[model samples]
Target: MIRLMFLLPILLCLGWYYFLRVNGVPLKQGKRGFIYILAFSTLVLGFFVLMMHLTNPG
Candidate 1:
């Protein structure tokens, strides 16, 4: 479970990267790309935080 908490976000990001490439999104060259990267980063960070909170005792 602990390992999964770290792996899940990486897997999800890879999937998302594949999806973007399949659609030919310019991942390296524009404002749109930056937005997508920013959003995904935020999502991954939030997921990790949530997992940590769930696994830790107060």
Candidate 2:
């Protein structure tokens, strides 16, 4: 369960990259895309952690 939390963002970013590549998006050409991915992944991870903490505060 904990491992999945970390892996989920990586998989998401890979999928996002593939989607962008397939659609011929040029945003990945600059740091903007990388920053977006990082921000998105961080949000996802933080959300998961927050939920887990809220549910299992021990």
Q: Report, for every candidate in turn, its global Cα lDDT versus the true structure.
A: 0.67, 0.76
| Runs of candidate 1 exceeding 4 Å displacement | 1-29
Candidate no. 1 TM-score: 0.49
Model 1 Cα lDDT, one tens digit per residue, 17-38? 7877888876564446446666
lDDT per residue, candidate 2, 1-58, as tens digits? Answer: 7677777667767777787788888654744666787898898888888888999958
Q: Judge candidate 1 against the unseen true structure and give its global Cα lDDT, from 0 to 1.
A: 0.67
RMSD to the native, candidate 2? 2.7
Candidate with the greatest TM-score versus the true structure: 2
Alpha-carbon runs more than 4 Å astray in model 2: 12-28
Q: Pick the lDDT winner.
A: 2
| Candidate 1, run of 10 with poorest lDDT | 1-10
How well does candidate 2 match the true structure in TM-score terms?
0.58
